[model samples]
Target: MTNDDSKVGDIPGKRSLRPLGGVLAAMAVSLTGTRISVVALPWFVLVTTGSATQTGLVAFCEMAPYVVVKAFTGPLVDRIGPRAVSWTTDLASATAAAAVPLLHALDLLSLPLLLVLVALIGAARGPGDLAKEVIVPEAAERGRVPLERAMGLSGVIERLASTIGLAIGGSLVALLGPLTALAVNAGCFALGSVIIKLALPRSMGHTAEEASSPARKTEPGYWRQFGEGFTFLRGEPLLLTVIVMVGITNLLDAAITSVLVPVWARQSGNGATAIGLMGSVMGAAGVGGSLIAAVVAQRLRRRLVVLTGFLLAGAPRFLILSFDAPLGVVLAVFAVSGFGAGFVNPVLGAVFVERIPRPMLGRVNALGDSLSWAGIPLGGLIAGAAVTAVGLAPVLLACGIAYFLTTNLAGLRREWQEMERTGGQSVPEPSSKDDASRGNANLAT
Candidate 1:
């Protein structure tokens, strides 16, 4: 069926609820598994080696693969279909996660081996994550959900996952050892993969061209398709600007979370649980922000929401850390910061879904996501060195100020204004005549 036809099935008031429920359920399971590993893995490294640098290195290794692999595989996801890509990669991640704990149990775990396993998981997960994102527009279409609401629901899902997952991760680590927690994580990934594969409607997987080109096939060559995606993104200025802005913010965020926060916790004498709790608090507050976005995001100016979110999210937590506030106060500050951040993704997601053509969704989404996340490893590295040199508090304060300035200042650019315009309108549904022409052209291939 056509996308317009897909939108017709939902009753106005209740339409977004069902598909959003499915998406949120899938995200909760998957992110819970990831969050558990986030806790368990670092704890394992720190306990085993007693080296902060080593722990940072492990994070770097994982993110390096994630960025590189995702950047290159966007076209593959577009060509092969997100459903198959998502399920297969999730299975691979589950296997990698399970291997870590099993090897540890056998007394065969080594640092290099652990890094390799995590890197593989990251690589697999990159495309898998992209696949899920690519499917959002389709899911929203099928559910007759407004694009903003669908995106807002995604933000809520992430926030809920972070809050619940961190809480559960900490508890699991305390009760069952890091290895056992990891095993549980593996199980969650497996279950999540199954749910996405089975629970989603078959029609939910259809691409923009699927209805018209049942027997037509694209060229089998991988590099050509990959090149096409890159080429398309290069020509799209508004999209490029969004990617760059997100990338800068991501870098700053990575530094804050991975490097500065740990140092701050150690200085404050609260230890790792405090770090986890800080994250949980932020996540909890983000839930409220995400709900607000879900309810009213479509009515507000999209760019203003994003800019405001940046202003609120970036500086406050850093200032809190710089002051060495008590645990409770720090948690509160994080909550405020997270609440601001919660609105960001939904706005950006809706913008992307509205502007990008469905035929190129996989590659473009993958490319944008990979580029935005590329700075994560570098941020960790820089934060580690900066803390080692300048001490943690001063660096954190500087980062907070810089983040506030950078984001707000960037909003003044003409490119950002163009992005706002591009995102404000709905994508027009293509005519059947256009679809038929594209199909005939495809059949000749």
Candidate 2:
């Protein structure tokens, strides 16, 4: 029952933010590109190929490999180091991304070729993104920030990136066309790669000493390492619950982002401007909520915060769209949803970090996140087909209802109670004088 203030970092000064800052900067840069590609890629497929199905197929091609590659990349990260994996993967992604526009400009790009390029991007991004997340706890420890606050700030950075990226992506697609936006995305990935490759000191993701240790040499093979992660996940009911719930929601979100929103903009004759506007608004509100959560949420009961956040963040946007509501009302609903969504991840990140040991972080986190995101690849596909089949309103309504049930009902499990039991870092040892001082203060007070 010690307060959060009882903890402090052993690192000198606790003044340097470089480790954490570098990680965040890389995350921001890369994520911004991914978000832009989200808008631009689909638009490119739709406008060029004139097929929503093709768009979904391309999305599926990208994300399926993303999940699979990231799942297996974890062991290598623990062994070879996340830093090298991160930059190299980003370089691959950049090359793949650049080829799309280059080939298209040459008028030599076929649909099959486009799909291959998109898949390559997904494969590379999978590892790169995981590497960055893997770096966070290490960076946080080095900087002496509370794990929860660091996660909150991470959420803020992600929200900020998503906001700015979507805004810029939408604008670029509208004003300059999808190819230009794609070009910018390639540049972002390249820059992010450079930052991680050279900007941060060598100690961030894994130590060279650790990498060379006999224990490292003796570590299990890839499948065995993966099995360890799988076993860890299978044993954690809370983590499983979160993964399943998030998986469903992520699927729905993918549907919205990849198909619903873009289709809505096109059908409404509002085009890319409206899509960008909605994403920007939601991201902005999410940033505000993440900031507030970082400041005050640590003291609150975890289950309540999680449940309340789900209630606010889920269902509304889908329901609003289903109603064919006025744009103003839809925007308002999205804003509220974004705010509620903000409280969720920081809390989730804290719980996840506390529950897992450092050694197993990469594999476990990769598996968990990949599973939670398992449905993402299919999201666009399902939404595209559904909207094409029964029309948009029905699909939106079904998704909204499903989202509402999943978020609210899923929180009822006894396993979720685990969130409250976990403590941050290891408990500190209290010295004799410290105990004596505390007793004296208690008596005097």
The number of the candidate with the highest lDDT is 2
Residue lDDT tens for model 1, 248-330: 88899989887788888888899988987888778888999998988888788878998999888998888988987788888
TM-scores for all candidates: the values are 0.87, 0.85
Estimate, for each residue in 1-445, the C-alpha lDDT of model 2 and write its tens digit: 8532222322333545676787888899999999899889999999998997798789789988899999888877766667788889999999999999999999999999998999899999998998888887767766767766788889998999888887789899999999999999999999999988765555555444445767666767788878888887788899999999999999999999889988887877778777766887888999999999887777778789989988888788888887777788888988998999999998898788766656677888899888898898778889999999999989989998999899877888888878884434321122322244334323322
lDDT of each: 0.77, 0.81
Q: Candidate 1: which stretches are off by over 4 Å?
A: 1-20, 51-53, 203-216, 269-273, 324-329, 420-445
Clashes of each: 0, 0
Task: State, as a TM-score between 0 and 1, how close model 1 is to the true structure.
Answer: 0.87
- By TM-score, the best candidate is 1
Residue 181 miss distance in model 2 (angstroms): 2.5
